[model samples]
Target: NVAVILAGGVGSRAGFSRPKQLVKLGGLPVVAHTIKRFQSHPLIDEICIVSTADHLEEIERLASSLKAHKVKKVLGGGTERRDSSLAAIAAYEHEALSGPLYLIFHDAVRPLVSDEVIDRVINALRHYNAVDVAIPCADTVVSIDQVTNEIISIPDRRSLRLGQTPQAFLHDTISTAYAAALRDPPRAHTDDCGVVLHYLPSEKICVVEGDTYNHKLTYPTDLLILEKFLQSNGGRRKVADTGDRQLTQLRGKSIAIFGGTSGIGEKMAELGERFGAKVSIGSRRNGVDISHAPSVQEFLKEVVATHGKLDAVVNSAAVLTYQPLEALSDEDIVSSVGTNYLGALHVARAAYPYLRESRGHLLFFASSSYTFGRAHYSVYTSSKAAIVNLTQALADEWDGADVKVNCVNPDRTATPMRTRAFGHEPQDQLLDAQTVALDALSVLVGETTGCIFDVERR
Candidate 1:
């Protein structure tokens, strides 16, 4: 398994005098975190980094300083992103790398990539010749006529997906495609995926799930968010993604799902039981109003009393308002905020004692909508954003007690609530609630804390 991390961009748009990849993000160059993610990955054997000519020395020095044994070399990149990727591919040929090699290319700007994202790309190479990573687009995208400044077409939001990296490909296949692409000087594709699609159209590219936190550093605002998140996260050892082992770990353990009557919450309850868990559902069906603190406290107390002990508390409940902010009634605004943000907090605070006693976990739900902060969904997006920050804060606060707090920012999922909001979308297009529930089960048994995962794709 070979990984090539692209860090050669000028990043003039970022308003940084230096290259954005070299810019300090939490006291380390942005590319360092990206390299370390692969270095720490169990499957990755060797790393080859590509950066600008001027920065290659510093990059090499940084890698050496970090005592990275896996880094094969730090080579100078070309004028374009594709050129850099081609450079790496050329080097692989020069080195006489053996046949049936799996190659991965990732943007250094997206420094917060998780092991699961890396694992998915690597794992897919077993069956797929080419693999791409992407999250479902949250916004309705439009294709406009550039010259006329008119809307040319409105594509189905369900079909649109926002692309991300590390894009994995069979080395021999991509090498041939890239060699053919280099023959055409007039053509330039934006990403490696585009390169594959254009030159290797006959090959099918499998799209795996991508993390929302696997964001590229483009603007100053992006840098601020990335820096703050990294600083807050500090450092922790990562847990291996042990598939069905999570089920065995949860067996016979008690868990309370605050919104476990419908949608993701209800499904988690069923999965928990199927995995041999003692599951308790806390929702309106059980007369528990999560928005109210006292009600949450009393209900959790009852849950613990009934179930013996609580191992994990997951809050999957949320409410949203899509109308104009000013037009929204004060009641609707408060209800949205209270239900989405405070409701999770109410559960977290109330369940902390039981979780602390068992050294268990706290899981919360966020939406990809939090990323865009789109208009008309101010209260909804703002509250979800607050939940993300709150997830980290609670993790920090509970660090001493060994309780892990994490958030899964799922893209559009097929649920009763989403159906009411986004009418008539094919159910098959949306993410299944059970998939997210299974992810939540792993988080419960995992070692990491203060992590935010994207549950966007299959």
Candidate 2:
């Protein structure tokens, strides 16, 4: 299967001086995110990008930085979107006669395309020649008169669907459709599916389910919405369980754990040692204050100096205060934000050089309250949310350098921090610290980044 990323548009609608595809969303360019989806997919055999002439060299550099090995061609596209699609199709024209080929057309701006959508399209191609992805329309559809600006006809909402990308077609099917389309091209036709439907009337174009998060980046506000989506896992649904699996990857690796004096951090450090990792623990008890940049930087510098390298750094250091906004003390607000939010920032900044050198992993901890604000723990909840955002931004920023960044959003856990805030909870009702620690270790060794692992008791 070949993935064709159409990035020819100037994106004047997005109000950017440059094309929106080159705009940085999380940390990388928007097109980089789209390319990564297909590049990492096991089923995708090759990737071809149709970029404008002015940005061709820049896109090539971006692909090279990402190590996009599957990118076979970065051809120059024409003025229209259809012309870009034709360029991708024409690239494989000679090769199509040798064997079967599947072409998946997708917009470079729609970076949130999920694996499920791609799978559905590929599966449908086995039974049908053409396939498209779309979601059921939630809004009412009305045909409006252009000149009078009045409603002409109302279409049933159930019959309406908003089209999305990763539209797939067999090599011969789309080629034949475009060949006929060139004789008298439709003026306003934008999608490949429409061309197939109009030219090849007998060919059936199947519709597959598309995710709501798989939206194209058009307006400026869409950038903020997509960033939030990426922070919230970007349409990933599976929750991982370590289940007593052996972490062989941790053996002989160097790990630095902050807030390792007690609680989840302590448990993680113990497990790291048990698994043969060269563990370096730090906390206020050991003259390491995460809230202080110099203190955190000095600790990491010593860890690297002692261990000879740093493979991973985990920042579980956090302060939680339960108090109403009106009754909270100035000291309470400062401590919570400083330790939880700014501390994560400091750790990321200090650890980047080492992690980038080793292509290492950086992990942070967030609470379940990060998704929403709680009454008494407003500052604490907001700080956790900030941590989630920081993890995603850093993941994008360091993707080219091969540094992985992720966060663990554990539910109410039986930790010393929780006991201090709300004492004496039932053991069964709370997640064990060891369980959460195991999950964190799995993330450190796993290949996923810019994700939130939710640890909930079964």
Candidate 3:
């Protein structure tokens, strides 16, 4: 199976100086994320990108940086969307003669296309010649007369669906449809599925279910919406279960842990050492205040000087004060934000150079409350939310440089910080700090990046 990414649009409607596909989302270009979806999927055997002539070189560079080894070709596309689709189909024309071949055509702007959506399209193609992905439309559709500014008819919403991408087809089926189109093209044709439906009436095009998050980047505001989606797990969520498994990948790796004096950080330091990692702990109690930028920079510099190369940096440093907004002073707000939010930022920025050189990982900590704000712990919750976003953003930004950035969102853990904020919780209700630390260690040694590993009590 082959995945063809259409990235030829100029994106005038998106209001971007460059094409919308080139716009940065999370850290890599929009098209990079789109390619990554198919690049990482197990079913996809090869990839081909159809891009504008002007951006062809840049797109090739991105594919190389992503190590998209599956990409077979990067061809120049015509002006229209169908033209790009045709280019992709034509590229595989000769290859189709060898045997049966399948092509999955997807939009480069829809980066959040899930594995489920791709799986459905592939499964449908097994029984059908052509397949399309779409979600049921919620809004009522109106057919309006062009002459008069009046609605002609209202269609039932249940019958309408908003179309999405990864439209799959057998190589011969799509090629035949396009061959007919070139001789007598339809006056108004949008997608390859439309051509197949029109040019070959007997051929049935199957419809597969797409997701709400598989939306195309059409307007400027859509970028912000996509960013929020990316921060919220990027449509891929995983539950970390270390389960007494020892991660030997940490052997000989140099790891730095902030807020390592107690709680999850301390436990992480202990486990890292147990796994043969050269561990270094930093905390305010140890004369290193993460909230202070210079303190973090100096500490990392020392770690590098001692170990020669830093493999992973974990910032579990956080401050949780459960005071209501009305009673909280300026100092209290600053303290919470500085430590929980800014401290993560400081660590990420300071650790980047080292991590990039070593192609290492950077991990941050987030609480379960990051999904929503909690009463009396508003500042703490908000800061954790920021950490989650920062982790995702840096994941994108540092992707090309080979630095992995991720966040660990653990449920209420029996840590000193939690104890200080909320007094005497039930022992069973809180997670063990060691358990959370183990999960963090697993992520640090793993290849997955730009994700939030949820650690919940079983």
Evaluation by TM-score, superior candidate among 1 and 3: 3
lDDT, candidate 3, 1-458, per-residue tens: 99999999998877899999999987779999898889878999999999999999999999998889998899999989888988888889899999999999999999999888999999998899999999999888899999997999999899899999989999999999888888984558888889899998999999999998887898989998898787776555445455666589899999999999899999999999999999999998889998899999999999999999999999988888988998999999988888998888889889999999999999998888998899999999888888888887788788889899989888889998888888999999888999889888988877777888778877
Residue 168 of model 2: what lDDT?
94
The weakest ten consecutive residues by lDDT in model 2 span 237-246
Clashes of each: 0, 0, 2
Q: lDDT scores for all predictions?
A: 0.82, 0.90, 0.89
TM-score of 1: 0.56
CA displacement after TM-score superposition, residue 301 of candidate 2 (Å): 7.6
Misplaced by over 4 Å in model 1 are 94-97, 231-458
Clashing pairs in 1: none
Q: What lDDT is reached at residue 432 by model 2?
A: 86
Rate residue 360 of model 2 by lDDT: 97
The candidate scoring highest on TM-score is 2
Looking at model 1, which ten-residue stretch has the lowest summed lDDT?
Answer: 233-242
Flag the better candidate by TM-score, 1 or 2: 2
Which whole-number lDDT from 0 to 100 does residue 202 have in model 2?
A: 97
- Residues 88-116 of candidate 2: C-alpha lDDT, one tens digit per residue: 99999998999999999999999989888
